[model samples]
Structures are given as C-alpha cells and as structure tokens.
Target: MTTPGHLYLVPAPLDFGCAVQSPLTDALPDATLRAAAGITHWICENAKSARAYLKRIDAIHPLATTIQAQNIVELPREVHKKGDHHGGFDARPLLAAALQGHDVGLLSEAGMPAVADPGSSVVRAAHDLGLAVKPLVGPVSLLLALAASGLNGQNFAFVGYLPQDATERTDRIRALESIALRTGQTQLFIETPYRNAALLQALVASLQPNARLSVSWGLTLPDGRTRSADVKTWKRTPAGPDNQTPAVFAIGR
Candidate 1:
C-alpha cells in the first residue's frame, strides 16, 4: 500500500490585496518558506493568488517545481462565499493527489488557512483520509490583534463577521459587549476592509463608556498599527483602523 502524503497548511502573508505587500521572508519563518517551496501540489482558495504566493517564495527559496509546472486546484467559489466549516463542502475529492502519495499544500489568500479564512473543509478531509496534517509557524491576524489588545486574551472568542444591517449589527455588538464585560472574555471580529471605519464608529457608539475597544490594521507590514482604548476615550480621541486596510477588532473589559 502506498503511504499517503502529508497536507501542509501554508499561511500567506496578511498583506493580500493591500497597496503594499511585505516581503514573504519578513512575515514567514524560514522553515515555513522552505516547506512551501518544496510542495508541488496544492489546494488553494484561488489559483492566481496561490501562484503569486509561490512566486514570492521562489524569490527566496527556489521552488521544487516551476509555478507553471505545479498542480493547483482551487476551491469552488460558493465555498469561498458561504465558508466550508459547516461540513456542507465535500473536500475529500480535492485530496486525490495526496492519496496518490504526492504532498499537498493547503493555502488561503492571507493569514492561516481554516482560521479566519476558508479552508477548514480541506483540513477535515485530510484527517478523515488518514493523511498527516502539518501547520507551519506563521502569523495569525486574530491572535496578533488579541495579543496587542490589552483585553482578556486568556478567555476570548472570534465571532467572525458581525451583521450587515445597522440595527442587527448594533444589537450584536451590545450582546458581545455584555459577554466581554460580564465574563471578562474578549470578543474579536473582523469587518470588510472598506467597512472598517464605519464598524469602528458603530462599535464606539454602541459600546458602554467603560468597555474597551481594540483595532489593529496592516498587521505584518511596515505601516501596521494597533490602537486600544475605552469607548469614551475613543469617542473623544477619534481613532480607528484604516478604511482600505484589513483589520481585526476586539472588545472587552
């Protein structure tokens, strides 16, 4: 019987779609780059983005196969929109290459796969197929924001994207605030890059005066910044994440 190949959870830099992209070496560890460079088969969110990431890696460590020579399979568009964690998506078929004893890399556009991004189904499928799953050391924006935020990092929850409706969004914000304040647990969430400023405003307006809010943006880039303060202080000082950049928001005592 042929031994199944391992699935490497490769993390791309957080600067995806940003105006300025940080060098991969600066954001990813040398070992991760080496591992990524050696993988010739991949299951990725987008084939184009995966090629771009591999090109960046090739500049540092030569790839085992040329970008054009690599076998890349992209997840379905519906999976990207609705997410794959609920078990609706069948990712086992995507692992045929791994089952054939060819190592496969699982990649997302940014940060770690299957964390804030859409690749959990692939990881779950790998486990079910009895293939080794290896996650390389890399930056995760949620944890980076949580660690930078002086909130209750020990007890925190990443609630994903909040509601889009104004009223529902406000209601959800208050509910999370209550949990953060009452249980001393940090509430973390992300917003569409364009809506970041508006969300920050809503968070500042909806949260209680004593509740703390933290916003971290451009995490691994040179212009990266993190600001944390109470709601009342935020209202007075008026600071927030850049509207065009990816950000992580947290609320707690």
Candidate 2:
C-alpha cells in the first residue's frame, strides 16, 4: 500500500498588504510559515493571490527550492461564488498531487481555509480518500472578533454573510437578534468592506433598543478596533468615518 501525502491547510495573513498593515511574521505562526514554505503543490482560491502569498512567505522563509506556477491549482470561480459544497462538487481530483505522494497545501484568500471560507470540499475529499489532513496555527478574524467582543464565546454560530437586499437584510438582522436575545448565543456575520456602514445602520435600526451589537474592524492591523454596546447606545454615539476595511459583526445578549 502506498502512503498518501498529507494535506496541510495553510492560513494566510488577514490582510494581503502585509508590508503596510502588519508584518507577515506577526500574522501567522512560525510553524505555519515553515509548513507553507515546504509545500510546493497547492490548491488555492485564486492562483494569482496564492502565488503572491507564497512569494511573500518565501521571502520570509524560503519555500521549496523551486516553487513553480504550474504547481498551484485554483479553485473554480464558481466555488468562490457559490461555495465548495455547492451541488456536491467532487474535489478529490484537486488532491491529485497528494495522492501521488506530494504533500499539498490548501489555501484560502484570508484566514484558515474551509472555515467561513472556500476549500471545505477539498478537506472533505481528503477524508474520503483517506489522506491525512493537518491544520496549522493562524489568525482567524471571526474568533478574534468574538474574543474582543466580550460576548458569549461558549455558544456562538457564525452565520456567514447576511442578506444584501435592504428589507431582507433588516428581517435577517431581527431574526438573528431574536435568537441571540432568547438563547444568549452569539450571532456572528460579516459584510463587504464597503457595506460596513450601511449594515451597521440597518443593524441599529432593526434590533431592539437594548439588544447588544459588536463590530470589529481591521482585526490584526494596527488600527484594529472592536466596540460593543446596546442598540440605543450605539445610536447615540456619532458614527466614525465609513470603514472600507474588512470587519466582523456580532450580536448577543
């Protein structure tokens, strides 16, 4: 029996502009960087971005002697739009390198792959094929936000992105708020960077006056900020400049 190569789930820095926002060494652990540097074969959400990330890491800790472009396979754009499990798409083929005895790395644009990000299908495929899967230590924005939010971390659900439509978004906010209020379960979600202010407004307007809301922005970056308060208190506070930075939003009792 041939031993299969391990599948390493590599996490990327929260911000691609590592040179500007924060040092790459600070965003990811040394072990993760070393693991990433050793894997030449990779399945990533975007080939270009993944290469750029690898290049950055290589600069920090030299990658395999000769990392080539052809070694990285990009996840379909459809996967990014829909998700890895959409229509039960089989991702086994992407792990061909691993099956062939070459250790493979799975990378997402930011944070850990397959956690509130694309690449779950590849992880599932690894399991189905009896390949070993390992996750390296890294920064996860959701958990960072939750920890800083001072909310119920023991019981929480990451609901992913909320609705974009105005009415639907408002309704979704109310429903999530209801759950948080009733069960003390923290409800977590994210919005497009540009839509941060708009969602904050909608959240404040839709949730009960006493319901608590937590907004974390620029996590892991120098200007990172997390603020939590009741709807009424949030409404009284003057809004800051519109944040175009990536952010996490959560609500809990």
Candidate 3:
C-alpha cells in the first residue's frame, strides 16, 4: 500500500493586496518556506494568485522547480463565497496526488488556509482520509489584530463578517457589543475593503459610548494601522479612507 502523503497547511503573507511586497523571510520562517517550496501539488483559493505567490517565494529560496511545473487545483468561486462546507464538495479527488505518496499543500490568497478562509472542506477531507495535517507558522491577521486591540484576548471569538444591510448590520453590531459587554469576549469581524468606512460609521453609531472598538487595516504592511477607542471617541474623530485594504474589526468592553 502506498503511504498517504501529509497535508501541509501553508500560510501566505498578510500583505497580499498591498502595493508593496513584504519580505518573505520576515513574515515566514525558513522551514515553512522550504516546506512550501518542496510541495508541487496545491489546493488553492486561486490558481493564478497561488502561482504568483509561489513565484515570489521561488525568487527568494527557489522552488523545487518552476511555477509552471507545479500542479494547482483551484477551489471554486462558489466555495469562496459560501465557504468550503457548502456540502457536495468532495475534496478527496483533489487529494489524489497525496494518495500516490506525493505531498500536497493547501494555500489561501492571504493568511492561513481553512481558518476564516476557503479550504476548510479540504482540511476536513484530509482528516476523513486519515492524512497527516501539518500547519506551518506564519502571519495571521486576526490574532495580530486581537493582540494589538488590547481587548479581552483571553476570551475572544472571531465572528467573521457582519450583515451588509443597514438595519441588519446595526443589529449585528449591537448584538456583538452586548455579548462583549456581558462576557468580556472580544468580538471580531471584517468587512469588504470598499465598505470599511461605512462599517466604521455604523459601528460608531450602533455601539455604546464606553464600548471599545478596534479597527486594524493593511496589517503587516509598512503603513498598517490598528486603532482602538470608545465609540464616542471614534465618532468625534475624523474617519480616514481604508482604501479597500483588508481590515479586521473588533469590539470589546
């Protein structure tokens, strides 16, 4: 019987969409880079973007081979929208290379795969198939934001994204705020880059004056900023454009 290959959960840098490229060595350890470079087969959120990331790493450490020689299987756009657990997604076929004793890597466009990112189905499938899953260390924007927020890090939850509708968004923010105040659990969520300012405004309007709100944008980038303040303070302060940079929003007492 062929020994099943291991699944490497490789992490990409948090500066994915930023204008400048972050140094790979600074963000990723050499072991993670080597592990990523060694794997040629990948289940990725976007094949083109994955190839580009691999090429960037290859420029520094040199991949086992060229990017063209790598085998990449992209997760469907629907998976990205509805998440990987939308049912009917059999990730076993994607791991066929692994069955043949060849290692496979799961990659996200930014940050770690399978965590608040499309590719959880693949990780679930790996567990079901008894494949050894190994996650390499790298930058995670959520943890970074939580640590920087100075909130209740001991008890926090990543609430994902908030509702888009005005009423629903306000309701959701208020609901999360209630939980934060009662349990001291830091509530974390994100918004589409273009909607950052709008969400910030809504947050300021919905949360109580004393409730603290933290907004982190362009994490791991040179101009990245993480600011935490009470809702009242935020309302008085002039709001700056996030410019569609990826951001994390957190609320706590």
Candidate 4:
C-alpha cells in the first residue's frame, strides 16, 4: 500500500557503541531498524560502505533482502571537484532514483548529509520531483565542533573543507578573520587529515594574535581532543591530537 517512489533521507549518527572506529555498519543500525524489517532502496555516499553494511545486517526477504543500496558515488562525483562545492548543481541521480519510485534514503559517508556533506544534491532533486524525503536524525560534525569549541555558538558558519592552495587559503582566511573579528561569529572549517599541521600554521599566520582559535580533532571518538586557545599561544607552540583521516577544525575571533 505504501508508495515505492517515496524517498527517505536518513542521517547516520556519529558514533559506534562509543567504539574505536565508527564504520558504516555502526551508522546503519538506525536506518535498518527504521526500515521496518523491509527495504528496497538506499543511496549511500560511498559504495564500499554500503556493501560492507549489507554484509553485516541480516535484511528480511522480499521487502527485506530485495532492498537495494545503490552506490551514488558518481552522483556526487559530478560536483566533487574543489571550489564548486556550493552545491545544488547536479540532480541526475536524485531524479533517476526518484523516477524509479523507490523510497530512497540519501546517506553520507559519516555525518548527516546536506549540511556539509554531498547529500544536498539528492535532497534538492527529491524536492523538485515532489517526492517525500524523510530525514532520520543523526550526528553532525559542524555542531559537534561548535559545542566543544567553547566559543559563542549563537552564530556560526560551517565552511566545510578549506582551500588547499596556500595563497588562496591564506586570502580566504584573511577575509574570514576580519569577519570573525567584526561579527564575533565562529568560522569553522576542515582540512585534509594529513594537512592538519599546515592548516593550523595558516591560521596562525593569517589570524590576529589576539583572535581565539578552537582546534577540535577526532570529535566524538576515542582519542578525541579539543583545545581553545589564543591564536598567539597556539601559534607559538602548536601541539594537539594526531589524526590520519576524518578530521574537523574550527577557528573563532
């Protein structure tokens, strides 16, 4: 009786039994449980995660095993390039998935999609197609870093990943530093895992000495560390947690 065309935009939480590594399996429990022992459509941010998830969860038959988790990597790939991440640019998969009349759930690799993730495209497409996009509440990295930063959370902007190039990144930081100083709004963004040190160095060089910087790494996970210190002190002596992948960074005036 339920329309198969309906789409559910689910959000996977940020933790795994408070475990060491929160893999896709750890995140899928809520979605699978909510699928009501039956499913037919799921669109995952990463193909590997979806496959690994299916292996662990024992899905029911017909409405259960028939549930297919399609890897929507290429959908995001159409807009995956750097600098063009403002989003709302692509809608092919969202359209295709909706046209198929499958109640699709758009999931990100880690945190809630569309905030700073790639699922926004699918969400927008669903809206255009007049399909219901149900959101399953879950963890978000932006809010996670903001709450821990000890900065004024009343206002903030999540800039996602910062520029990788030195000159452009520095210029962008200069502009954001001025805004942070004037508006007192926290400026939060992330860099590639390995480039943590470099991004921190850029912050030190670009921001004012008196400006406050909150560096949160490995949020909501084992070895999680967060530090809010003056830019001057943080720069003179930079030291904090070490992470290999999946990191977050935030800086405020």
Top candidate by lDDT:
1
Clashing pairs in 1: none
Query: Could you tell which candidate, 1 or 2, scores higher by TM-score?
Result: 1
lDDT of each: 0.93, 0.87, 0.89, 0.65
Ranking, lDDT, top scorer first? 1, 3, 2, 4
Candidate 4: minimum summed lDDT over ten consecutive residues — where?
58-67
| Model 1 agreement with the true structure over 91-144: per-residue lDDT tens digits | 999999999999999999899999988999999999999999999999999999
lDDT of 2 by residue, 73-158 (tens): 98888898998755487899999889889899999988989988899999999999999999999989999999999999999999
Q: RMSDs, each prediction?
A: 0.8, 1.7, 1.3, 4.0
The TM-score, computed over Cα atoms with residue i paired to residue i, of candidate 3 is 0.96
lDDT of candidate 3 over 69-98, digit per residue (tens): 999999878888788655568888899999
Q: In angstroms, how far off is 79's CA in candidate 3?
A: 0.7
Candidate 3 contains a number of clashing pairs equal to 0
Of models 2 and 4, which has the larger TM-score? 2
**On residues 1-253, what C-alpha lDDT tens digit does candidate 4 reach at each position?**
5343766655654442233665444434555445623444566666666544444444421235532543333345655453224654766555564576656656665667666766676676777777877766556777877898888799888877777889999999988878888899888888666787888778888888888988876665657778888888987788864546455667676
Model 2 reaches what TM-score against the true structure? 0.95
